[model samples]
Target: EDKVVQSPLSLVVHEGDTVTLNCSYEVTNFRSLLWYKQEKKAPTFLFMLTSSGIEKKSGRLSSILDKKELFSILNITATQTGDSAVYLCGAGGTSYGKLTFGQGTILTVHP
Candidate 1:
């Protein structure tokens, strides 16, 4: 069975603040770590990290996986009010394309 856990279930921040979200997991056969952002609709894929140490990044979001520690971290810099949403972390197991997701972390960014 694969399980994922995310810390700081919720957060409140102001615009331009930087935040770091944590995720740890345990899986039968780990394949990859995935990050997603959800507002009202379906979760939008943010990043997929398979290799340790290498970071995947977008304009204001970045993530990295540490395979040995079975953990991953998502960093959001200069957050905007529009960035407020639920952040999700998922663990990919040997079952291709199937992911086990953790309880989402709700982020509230104020202007």
Candidate 2:
């Protein structure tokens, strides 16, 4: 059974505090790992790490993949209240964009 698990299902951080979100998985044939931020209806893509691109960074957010370890991590630096959102991790297989997701980590940034 393919599955993804994230730690500290919920977190509270003060402004400017750095936070790290962890995602671990077990799958049949892992093709890639995807990170998303969920604020409303659906999650929005943040990073997609494959064998070719194992690390991705954008602004205050960054993520890395470990194919051998079968897990990934998301790091947020200089957090802000606006950064409060649910973080989701998904595993992508060879079937196009087909992904199995984790329950999600709810992050709250307090000002």
Candidate 3:
């Protein structure tokens, strides 16, 4: 069956720490993998991975995809309390942007 899995469901860290979050998936007809940050109500888009081996970075956050392994990783550096949020990864299949998401990785950054 096609499904998505995320590791380290939750983490707690002091400010300025670096963390790595993982997402793996298996889909019958894969298209892309997307990452999101959910701080309050709506989730904000982070990265969209369609090709493997290319890393996407924005500010202190970065992500990479491995199509062969069917997995992806999100890394955050110099974390801050404002960075505390739920990191979500969703896999898009051949079905028109339809995505199946992993549970989420909750990161707590304490000052």
Judging by lDDT against the true structure, name the best candidate: 3
Tens digits of lDDT, candidate 2, 48-108: 8886435688999999988878889999999999889999999977776788999999999
List pairs with backbone clashes in candidate 1: none
lDDT of 1 by residue, 1-111 (tens): 678999989999999999999999998888988899999999999999999999999999999999999999999999999999999999987886799999989999999
lDDT of each: 0.93, 0.89, 0.95
> Where does candidate 2 clash, by residue pair?
none
Q: Which candidate has the top score in TM-score?
A: 3
TM-score of each: 0.97, 0.94, 0.97
Q: Give me the runs in candidate 1 sitting further than 4 Å from their true place.
A: none
Give me candidate 2's TM-score against the actual structure.
0.94
**Any idea what lDDT model 1 has?**
0.93
Off by over 4 Å in 2: none
lDDT of 3 by residue, 1-111 (tens): 779999999999999999999999998789999999999889999999999999999999999999999999999999999999999999988987889999999999999
lDDT of 3 at 25: 98
TM-score, cand. 1:
0.97
User: Which of the predicted structures, 1 or 3, would earn the higher lDDT when compared with the native?
Assistant: 3
